[model samples]
Target: MNRCLSGLVGILFVSISLVSCQTDEEIKRQRYITEGILIFKNNCANCHQDKGQGVASLYPPIAGSDYLRDKKSVICLIRYGQQGKIVVNGKVYNRPMPAQPQLSDLEVAELITYMYNEWGGETKLTNVKDVTPILNACKK
Candidate 1:
């Protein structure tokens, strides 16, 4: 009887643990979205607009930007801002967006995750580990 009770308790414990873990991804996704939205509003909303639609040829749209579609390039550019000119979404945006080195890797990841999931782009759930290498590889 004791053996059966112990087994039942262990199984119950494992079931509870698994159930708690089930929502971790969703929680992380929500947290990333929240963090990204805050960062964007604070730093990017002025130029990118609240909806990520660029400011009429001044700033380029971030929602469906080609730069974002190329994940590697976008990650690199974010880690190290590009100068000169670049074309995004069939339009040429000439302004230089300064690199956000002050932001932590986790913050940057959350920002990227939010951007990818938000607006009209593909929903990619980015994490700190996912983007850390990109930052490390950047020459700055």
Candidate 2:
């Protein structure tokens, strides 16, 4: 009976250890994603839609978008906005995307992380350390 109890405790310990084994980066990524979801819902979902499927021909879809291929441009546009016509998945959208001047560098990074993970077929985090320089360079 004592041996069985010890075995059960050992199994419980291993299970807990495994659950707690996520790296610090993984934890940060999850936090960024959560914040990003809130930001997207509050700021972007109106045009981009909740699932990023976009709104008909008026807005362009972010999911599986060819525009994502130019990540640097995407980052710049998110903060500075876009004017004139743009093409996504062979569809041309002429509407201008307003700039999100209120979003900080960290917030932009989080938003990108969420967008890429959820729709851009990415499984990694977009760290703010990497975003700040790009944002600084894009300042007009």
Candidate 3:
């Protein structure tokens, strides 16, 4: 009976350990989303709206935007805010988006991740490594 109980306890421990161990993909996805939400709420929600739909033609709608779906362009825009006229969903938004250079690459990646996942996009995860180059390239 003692041996049986010990075996059962060991199995329970293993199960708990496995449950606690999140895969890299899962961890990345969670990190990406959580960071993204915080950054978005703080930096973007005012102009882009809480849902990323933007406020009329004043700002561009980020939610369900074809522009956001293009990872390269999106990264560029995030790293260095676009100047002059830009169009989203056939609407022209001429306002300049101020550069958020204060944020780290990791934070920017997280913000992008949150925007992609929350706003009718696919499950592709954006990591710091992927974002760093784009951020560096933006300066040149």
Candidate 4:
């Protein structure tokens, strides 16, 4: 009986540990996504719309954007913006996208996390630690 009880306790401990880890990840993802939504709304919604649908030919839709294929470029673009012409889901947009120098690396990570999850079909959190170096190396 003691051996059986010990085995059950071990199983319970393992289960709890797995659950704790999963919950921790979920929490981080939720926090990043939440902050990202706010950042997008305040900074990008004017051109991209609340749903990321963008406006006509002048602005590009972020929802289901093919440009998200290049995650690094997306991150850099957020920090330094874009200029000239770029194709989004086959549409051409040439307007200058103003850079947001005010956003910290962490804020950019949160925004990236949210945009990917919401529109790019990503399930992982883009941690600030992972984003800092990228931002530092941005050529734009």
lDDT of 4 by residue, 1-140 (tens): 69999999999999999888777778999999999999999999999999999999999999999999999999999989999999999888999999999899999999999999999999999999999998889855
Output the number of the lDDT-best candidate: 2
What TM value does model 1 have? 0.78
Error at 131, model 1, angstroms: 0.5
The true-versus-predicted C-alpha distance at residue 137 of model 1, in Å, is: 0.9
Q: Give the CA lDDT, 0 to 100, for residue 63 in model 3.
A: 90
Model 2 C-alpha lDDT per residue in residues 1-140, reported as the tens digit of each score: 69999999999999999879988999999999999999999999999999999999999999889999888899999999999999899999999999999999999999999999998888899999999999999997
Question: Candidate 3's C-alpha lDDT?
Answer: 0.83
- Tens-place lDDT digits, model 1, residues 6-112: 99999999999987886777788888999999988887788789998888877889877777767767777776777888888788879888886777888888888
Each prediction's TM-score against the native? 0.78, 0.93, 0.82, 0.83
Q: For each candidate, what is the lDDT?
A: 0.81, 0.95, 0.83, 0.93
TM-score, candidate 4, is: 0.83
Badly placed stretches (over 4 Å) of model 2 are: 1-8
- Give the Å shift of residue 45 in candidate 2: 0.2
The candidate that wins on TM-score is 2
Model 3, 9-73: lDDT tens per residue?
A: 99999999997897888878887898789899899888998889888879889998877757877
Runs in model 4 deviating more than 4 A are: 1-21
Question: What 10-residue stretch in candidate 1 is worst by lDDT?
Answer: 118-127
Candidate 3 at 104: error in angstroms? Answer: 0.7
